[model samples]
Target: MTPLLETRDVGKTFGSVVALRGVSMTVERGGVTCVLGDNGAGKSTLIKILSGVHAPDSGTYLVDGEPVRFGSPREALDRGIATVYQDLAMIPLMSVWRNFFLGSEPPARGPSRALGGFDVATAKRVAREELRRMGIDIRDVDQPVGTLSGGERQSVAIARAVHFGARVLILDEPTSALGVKQAGVVLRYIAQARDRGLGVVFITHNPHHAYPVGDRFLLLNRGAGLGEYGKADIGRDELTSLMAGGAELDELAHELRRTDTPS
Candidate 1:
């Protein structure tokens, strides 16, 4: 089977600074590809390239076995590539339905060819139905989105992307700010998206969170490729150690240890 998304020898640089180097990976349909890294790692850069925020300086991007270039985010969206950043991107003061249909509102039409514009009622009904399909039970679609929990907000964003026809979903640090239970809720939704046949690129620093849901893992350090491993080739502890800079961490811990002395 062809990968839903693939990057070959992808690299990005800013003036004299390199943000990514010869990075390559694939996200298959119905699978999760977890990109793990700590601060200053190239995880953000990789996602930007994938989501079309910035085109790679060199190398190729392929979607469904065809080469393509995304000049802007709209181009990526046109090709069914959607990204949900850490911020959830919802207007806190707006109603759930409003936020759901913010940029892509449905249109109202009569018999004539040039008949209509934003259909508020239809948008609300469709938003409610989409959320319901994802098993998200909202008390009131008219309530402010800020009224929902962090997890619920994230789930709403996911459902919005899926509803808008996102074939490849890139989630950037989705669980970084949530409590354990809330994070679990988001993870379940990630799995739900995967099960529904969307290629998921889950960018996170937490291995424990990634292990259970991820089908493949790509490790990065300091703008360079560390390695990419499948579930069968890696374990949680190994992933953690690599992200933490294994030997460097061990050396620091050893040097900081206090010794007991006798006179």
Candidate 2:
């Protein structure tokens, strides 16, 4: 089957700086594609291009085998591509239901609809249901989102995207800020999202976090791809080594050992 989303030989340049060069990856239904890279590895550039925040100066982007260049995030959303950023774009002080609906609230009926009122009842019910479906347990939808744990907040964002008909979910470093247990919880939710048949793009610097949940891995370094490998073709240790620049690390270790040796 054709991938839900695909990019081929994509590249971007900002002034004299090349943000990405010849990067390619694919997102398939019910699978997670992990983009592993450190800072300035062109991860952000790839995300922007995928989510329509910016266009690549080179190469083709396709959805279901048809080439498409989205003009804005809305266009991407219209195509069932949703991105949950690191900040999550949620209001801390707002109620869970409120944050879930945000700009896309269902209009209240009759006179209330004419008065620009939203269906609070429906929003609350659906938000709770969606969260439950994603295996996210919240005590109450009326409670302030700020009171939730970091993992819960990330799950909420994921659940929100899935609830809104997202076919391909792009998550930007969702586990980077949490403790080990909390990160595990978020990873579980990511697995849940993939099991539910949403193509997931998980961007992170941590290979350990990505390996267990990812079906495919795309390694990036200094705005270029190291390689793209399927889980069958790569092991966890190999993934980690590649992400850390294995040869470079080994050479550095040898140098350090030599320096510490007695004359």
Candidate 3:
């Protein structure tokens, strides 16, 4: 089957600095494609292009086998591509339902728009339904989003994206700031999204977090492609080593080791 989203020879640059070089990958429907990299490994650059925050300098970006060039983030969203950043983009003091409908609130019909700007009842109903679809249970939709745990917040973000006609979901470091148990919750929701036939691009520095949920892994190193591997082609340890720059780290550690001298 053809991938839901694919990038061919994608490259990005700013002034004289190349942030990404020939980065290519695919996000298949109902599958999780984890992009793994350490700091300065071009992960952010690649995702920015994919999420429509930045345009690629040279490449072909395809959505459903049709070529596309997104001029803005809203363009991507309109094409059913949603991005969930690490921040989650929720207002702490706002109710969960309000945050869910923040920018995309349902407009009131007929005249008297001033009296009925947003359909609060519909927002709450949709938010609860979406959360339930993702296996997330909230005691009340009227509570502030800040009251929810990190994992719960991430789940809500995912649910919101899914509800908003998102066919491909890009998650940026979803588990990086959570505890072990919380991270597990986020992973489960990722699986739920995939099960619902949405292509997921999971970005993270942690190999352990990706190995279990990812169907394919794209490794990046120093703003270049390290290569792509399927789950059967790579192990957890190998993924970790590659992300850490492989043999160079081992050699550097060996050279830095201090030998004990007998007195």
TM-scores, all candidates, are 0.94, 0.99, 0.94
Candidate 1 at residue 200, lDDT? 99
Q: Cα lDDT of all candidates, in order? A: 0.91, 0.96, 0.91
Check candidate 1 and list the clashing pairs: none
Runs with alpha carbons beyond 4 Å of true place in candidate 3: 109-114, 258-263
Kindly list the per-residue Cα lDDT of model 3 for residues 81-141, writing each as its tens digit: 9999998889999999998888889977557457768777778998998899899998999
Residue 123, model 3, lDDT:
81
Off by over 4 Å in 1: 109-117, 258-263
Candidate 2 residue-wise lDDT at 136: 93
Please, what are the lDDT tens digits per residue for candidate 2 over residues 157-180? 999999999999999999999999
The candidate, 1 or 3, that scores higher on TM-score is 3
What digit string (tens of lDDT, one per residue) describes model 1 on residues 48-158?
Answer: 899888999988999999988889999999999999998887899999999999978887666532575778789999999999887788899999999999999999999
Which candidate number would show the highest TM-score if scored against the true structure?
Answer: 2
How many residue pairs in model 1 have overlapping backbones?
0
